[model samples]
Target: MRDNIILACQTCKHRNYTSTKNKKTLPQKLELKKYCPFCREHTLHKETK
Candidate 1:
């Protein structure tokens, strides 16, 4: 099934975006470097519960 997840900024702890992933395929939380307007720089974003 498809699961909805939120990507939050690691530094500012802001919810930046939302994306969906297949639960059966990716059972782990997602992480990536994304641009944050609040931080004004690229930061590591982690999946939020």
Candidate 2:
């Protein structure tokens, strides 16, 4: 099982990948600083709490 999951950037949906190695604290890095490779921008991802 994973700690959390979410779908961000409806425009470039499923354009990025998230693995078990990608981990971060809530309301901080994980929720605020998700760098979207497709969009080439840092978008706020809604972490499923």
lDDT of 1: 0.95
User: Which one is best on TM-score?
Assistant: 1
Clashing pairs in 1: none
Candidate 2 global TM-score: 0.37
User: Over the stretch 24-43, how does candidate 2's per-residue lDDT look in tens digits?
Assistant: 43334343457787788887
Stretches of candidate 1 exceeding 4 Å from the true structure: none
Give the Å shift of residue 19 in candidate 2.
Answer: 8.0
For residues 1-49, could you state the per-residue lDDT of candidate 1 as single tens digits? 8989999999999999899999899988999899999999999999998
Provide the lDDT at 24 for model 2. Answer: 45
Give each model's whole-structure lDDT. 0.95, 0.51
**How do all models score by TM-score?**
0.93, 0.37
Question: How far off is residue 6 in model 2, in Å?
Answer: 3.8
- Model 2: runs farther than 4 Å from truth? 15-30
